[model samples]
Target: MAISRITTVEVTSEHIGVKGEPNISYIYSRYYRAPELIFGATKYTTAIDIWFAGCVLVELLLGQPLFPGESGVDQLVEIIKEKCVEEDYEI
Candidate 1:
């Protein structure tokens, strides 16, 4: 499988793990959610996570995400219809 640019990865049922971004984020600190990711002292005095939990809670009541996508960028786009700018899309 390594030939012709094809590759194979082996996994066991018990070894399953997520292959993309981490959900835990200093950037995604629970106290901030708006049009963009805000950092630093701006993250203070606002219960950002509480807001997100409220949003998700509402979505759950509706039986779906208020917004959903196949990737994190897609998910963000669904949120505000704008791309997350200046990201270095590298491994």
Candidate 2:
């Protein structure tokens, strides 16, 4: 799943406690999210679809979600810029 702007996030349950089994997140839609992105006034908002496309691309290359950022802003900032060594990047 994907979200836009990340209105808010609940992290109390994400850290500590059992060291990672599973986590659930409740995301709120903002002024420039999903539907608005496609048809609303902010439909032209680039962040709308860009996130999804970026995700799929990560899945294809790394076989997983690109950035599991602790927060929304961090996630948005952490794009698929390649984690491998510089030498590995060049064929």
Candidate 3:
């Protein structure tokens, strides 16, 4: 299978304001949203796009979303589960 890549076109956008600006709208697909965005961070950097690119890369490798959350909160939970949960830890 061909590995899909995230191109500049897929990641380009024209959001108003620069980094550290307050109350910036959270406008991103939930599956590819950065952790900062999920945490309601208004002042964020372009690093969020890098996070999105990583998510896309993971999906391309696994053929599914790394964090397949149904909602915003669920997305956070998925991230926490992946990062914080131990191999022996039970739900």
RMSD of each: 15.0, 15.0, 3.5
lDDT for each residue of candidate 2 in 14-76, tens digit (9 for 90 to 100): 432231322122222221123322232322334444544555555556544555555544443
Cα TM-score of candidate 2: 0.31
Candidate 3: residue 30 lDDT (0-100): 82
Model 3 worst lDDT window (10 residues):
4-13
Number of the candidate with higher lDDT, 1 or 3 = 3
Which regions of candidate 2 fall more than 4 Å away from where they truly are? Answer: 1-47, 80-91
Against the reference, the lDDT scores of all candidates come to 0.41, 0.38, 0.74
| Candidate 2 accuracy as lDDT | 0.38
lDDT per residue (tens digit) for residues 15-66 in model 1: 3323342322334322224333322233222354455666556554655555
Model 2, residue pairs in steric clash: none
Candidate 2 lDDT at 82 equals 40
Which residue pairs show collisions in model 3?
none
Q: After superposition, how far is residue 39 of candidate 2 from its true place, in Å?
A: 20
Q: List pairs with backbone clashes in candidate 1.
A: 30-48, 30-49, 31-48, 31-49, 32-48
Best by TM-score: 3
Q: Which candidate is the best by lDDT?
A: 3
